[model samples]
Target: MAKKLEYKDLLAAGVHFGHLKRKWNPKMAPYIFMEKNGIHLIDINKTLVALDEAAKAMKGVVRSNKKVLFVATKKQAREIVEQVAKRTGMPYVTERWLGGMLTNFSTIRKSIKKLNSLEKLMKSESYENLTKRERLMMERKKEKMEKVLGGILEMNRLPGALFIVDIHREHIALAEAKRLGIPVFAMVDTDSDPTSVDYPIPANDDAYKSIELIVNYIGDVIEEAQQERKQEKEAQKLQAEENKKRAMDEGADLENAPESHDEEE
Candidate 1:
């Protein structure tokens, strides 16, 4: 079972902190607990609810053996997003959000293919036969591609879901996801519109502590589900082996005993 998120954790991470009063969005009124001085405070209860719902959905995706792409291109979130996503073995985008990343997935895949081919060429002996200038050019290209597409190299298909850090700033990514009919899980600050995402965890999207805490919880859930799925497959394999052994034993007994009875009769 996934760990239940407590209000204390959220509070400690300053997840309840929201944008300045003047920048608040009306749609976020329901999630806003109250205004503190000049800033808005998010409702802790609502944050927990939204988080649990999103976590459950993400777990479902992992159990089904599907990927959830994590997007956090903002300065405060880039490193944290990459670390967490890497720990969970999930694809992530911490650099610029490429337009049509989801909608133009076919072209993106072709690029991934090219990147892979480049890798293979680098690993092959023929690569050593290239001129020094040509090799230097190839190396630079590979490094650039690796920085952006490395996390997603294994992701041949479109992700089952998206977990975005800042929905407003990553709007292009959100739009592409929506266009592809992929569900979105996002960290929605008071200034952002929650309605755009399928699962919106309202909190301080800009804070490093807030994003780290929430992302860590999610990463834990994904890893747990992945472990469970592996156990299930192992159990099924064991059951099949046992059934096969029993059938073989029964056939051997019949063949060894039944012929004698027929001869006596």
Candidate 2:
């Protein structure tokens, strides 16, 4: 398991910082420790507790061999989320979240299929036979589609859960997940509604450092779970091989022991 998150680490990352006091959501009062100057200070203890719960939930989803789609379109969090998703081999939406991405999944899949066909066509010898203008148009389309959907190419089905940076900003993604009954895990800022998500980790969602620390921790949980799943599969395969070998050995022994069976006759 990865090292447990410490209060000092979260402090150093400015995870306790929240929106201005006036902008604070009443629903997040439990997570607000106090007001510092004009801003709300998030409760570090509650942050830790919420983070642990979210981590466990994400671990369970990944260990089941299901995808957890990462959504972070804001400038500060986009790259960080993309890197974590790539490293974990999970799907992500860093550029933009298309409407009906989860609710109308079949249509989105068709678009992905079209992108794939375009790629294959571009790689074939016949691609060169096309006029230059035609090739250019196709190339532009490919680039646009890749920018939007490249991160989710491997996601052939709906994700088991969602890990989002700012739930307020990614409300559309959250709504889609909810519509599909997919669990959502998100960083809920003081201005956001914690009750909207299934797993809400109350923290400073706007700070790059804060988002990075929390998102990285979640990524570690996913990676650890994936490793455990891999180990379990290997062990099961080895056990099955041993059982097959033992059964074959028993069959050989039985074949050789048949000579004494007629002695009673």
Candidate 3:
């Protein structure tokens, strides 16, 4: 089992409500309070079940080596998404989601392949051995192209599941995932419709602290799954080695028995 990341630790890490607190939006107060206090306004029992389901789904994804797309449109969400991605070693979409990212994954993969090829070429002796001025020019050109293809290159492939911070703003990505038959897990705000998502974690999306807490929790689940997989592999290897040794020992015993049989004859 993975070590649980405490909510207090996340708070200590300075996950707080963003500038929206000062903004005059009556609709945002509930979310803001929920975030600050790490409270879930929804049914606590149902929320626990939902979290467990999400964790199980995440485990399945990790077992299958499926990619998860972490997305957020708001500034706080963007930060939380980045943290989640970093912790889980998954890809994220902090910037806007490109149209057809899920449906047109092959094209995006090709772009990633191209970028990899270019990166390789740039690192090769032939490229590196060029005149200083020529190398600098080539690097500059590569940087420009990389910047242009940043979004596609960052993702490089379709995600098996989508994790969104703000479902309302990232509706297009969710819709595309639905169209492509991908599962979605999101931190749904009260004003947002939870029915749209496959796994809706109804919580305070407005509060930076709350968002970070939830995202971090999910990220911890993924890391735990990864560690479990690693341990399983090690155990299999050890079992195989033990079987091999046992087989050798049995063979030796059989060989000795033959000598005893010869003596009896």
Candidate 4:
């Protein structure tokens, strides 16, 4: 579990800042601490609660051996989200959200498979057999597809959960997750409605520091859970080996035991 962040920590990271007064959402009133300088200040306590909820939910997904897809296409969040997601080996979408990404998952899977087949062809001897024009065309198609689907190429199934940055901007992704019954964890800014999200962390979504801080935190939690899972697997392997050894030793002892079998002597 992550250490509880103090008010100063959130403030320093600029997570307490909100949008302009004119852009505030009424549904966010519960999480608002106050208004200062025409900007709505987020309630630090609520932020803490929401952050804990989102972190716990994300950790739960990893602990259950389920995948959580990260989505953040906004300029400020794109780099950080991609870096953290790649490091964690989780799927991410830093580009435009394709409609029906969840609803049309089967079709999307076909495209992913096509990308994989193209990559195999590119590496095979058959690639050399093709004409130069044909090879160039294939390369162009692969490059374009990779830009859209590369991060999620390894994903074979719909994610167990979706962690989104800037909920307002990624509403399409959120809606898809909601329709599919996948849990959603998002950074809900003052202008965004928190009601739509399963777990909402109300904070400054526009600040790079805020996005980086939260994304890295989630990444760390995922890495930790994965490490724990590895250790468990190793422990199970060792125990199985010990059990096997014990069984063999017991059998050997029984065979070596002198039986007072009616010795003819």
Candidate 3 backbone collisions, by pair: none
Instruction: Provide the TM-score for each candidate, comma-separated.
Output: 0.91, 0.95, 0.71, 0.89
Across 96-211, the per-residue lDDT of candidate 1 in tens digits comes to 77787888889889989999999999999999999999999999999998888887888889999999998989999999899888999999999999999999999899999999
**TM-score of candidate 2 against the unseen true structure:** 0.95
Q: Residue 221 deviation, candidate 4, in Å?
A: 0.9
lDDT of each: 0.92, 0.93, 0.71, 0.89
lDDT of 2 by residue, 1-265 (tens): 7678999999999999999999989999999999989999999999999988988888889889999999999999999999999999999999999999999889999999999999999999999999999999999999999999999999999999999899999999999898888999999999999999999999999999999999999989999999999998999999999999999999999988857555675
The lDDT, on a scale of 0 to 1, for candidate 4 is 0.89
Sort all candidates by lDDT, best to worst.
2, 1, 4, 3
10 residues in a row with least lDDT, candidate 2: 256-265
Best by TM-score: 2
lDDT head-to-head 1 vs 3, winner:
1
Question: In candidate 3, where is summed lDDT lowest over 10 consecutive residues?
Answer: 16-25
Per-residue lDDT of model 3, residues 169-226, tens digit only: 8888889999988999997765677778888875657777777777888888888888
RMSD of 2: 1.7
- Candidate 4: which pairs clash? none
Question: By lDDT, who's the top model here?
Answer: 2
Per-candidate clashes, comma-separated: 0, 0, 0, 0
**TM-score of model 4 (CA atoms):** 0.89
